[model samples]
Target: MRPSSALVLAFAASTLAQDQIPLVDKVKGWFAQATAAVTSAVPAAASSPVASGRAKVAETIQHPLTLENWKETLTVDPSASTPTTQEWLVYITGGNATCFGFCGNATKAWNASLPFLAAKPNAPKFAVIDCDAEPLLCNSWSVGPPSLYYFQIPKPLADQSAPAATVRYQPLNRTSTTVDTFKKLVLDNDFEKVEPYEGYFHPFNGELQQYGLALPLAYVMWGFSKMPSWLPMILISFMSRTFM
Candidate 1:
């Protein structure tokens, strides 16, 4: 073959090879590009206005319900001549570090309903409890995390020594529908189907249960107090030596 013709044939072979790439390889290349684009988009989407707005709502609207503030947050003063009519809506959930399953979606729905509930007149007070933070308070109430409880405290709040009437929101799924129902329940103050809180008030059965729980620890401490101070030090030294 002529040298010039040989060069032209080689060039044509290269061009044909390029065009003859396998279909599966081309598809894989396209898929990789698409996946990269989606991955890059996710962080931006996560930090979008919707997410920021939810964060803002959580900060501004929901009050952290702790053991210290639970009574002040939930109960009302009956002695006041001009008693204010107020009730409570509590969202109980596990800690962020330990949360799983429906906790994320349930929390999102709870946060989303706050703005609507807060806008209404005579809106029920909103509080949230992190079960991981207030395990004792949650346990006394026999409440599991990621649950909603609506409390309707009756008058003579002090005399009504029983656990307040409450209704729990139990939804089959976590969605906007749950949010709407939560808001509606608060605004309407509709507790036609209320149930006595199975959990005891701290002043009542709860206090006794708390003491019962602490009895073992108290006994241990008492035993320690009776022991010679040198005993603990010797035990500690022995344990350290054993471990070593």
Candidate 2:
């Protein structure tokens, strides 16, 4: 039988609503499943042993000493550690807390020969400061972990009031990290060659400069003097005649 127009329109609207409702339910169900899957995975990941092991490792790693703990000695601030007026051979070392092999080697090498070097009549003062323990001091020295430096703090003159300047010793070409090599470097190079010194200058430089100035003149005079003594008088007469 042919349906009435109004009834047919109503029936079409109801069918459309029913089709849209199922689509909406399907989308909601898919989202719920995805959320459940993610929520279930989170706790499983948190309970992982690998994550726990990494935490344990991070805890086990030892950090370096703080600046406050920095002392003036290897074990103590020795009573006989008198301040000196000479230059200093400062060993800025680090990585001991972590048991770094390089630091171990360098410290061992320095320890072996330091006593002998300290006993010399005019030898420089020696001090060992951990790099990590005193970062600011080490950074001021412009050195890195496990390195040696020569430092000098010249006393202010009797007439001056300002602080004395810090002098850093430059190794001209020395690179070996051994005790004997260090001693040789200390022996071979004069500390005065470096700048920022007080009442200390390279004495030979002036003489060398004077010699440099006189060398050419001496050479010319020598060549002239080698000629006969009569040559100059003859040349003078010839010049006088030509100019007359």
Task: Record all residue pairs in model 1 with backbone atoms less than 3 Å apart, i.e. clashing.
Answer: none
* TM match of model 1 to true structure: 0.54
Off by over 4 Å in 2: 1-85, 96-100, 162-166, 169-176, 190-244
Model 2 lDDT tens row, 152-214: 444434453324434544422212356665565466554455564232221112232235543
Total clashing pairs for each candidate: 0, 0
- The number of the candidate with the highest lDDT is 1
lDDT of 1 by residue, 123-165 (tens): 6777888876776566545555667777666545445444434
Worst 10 residues of 1 by lDDT: 168-177
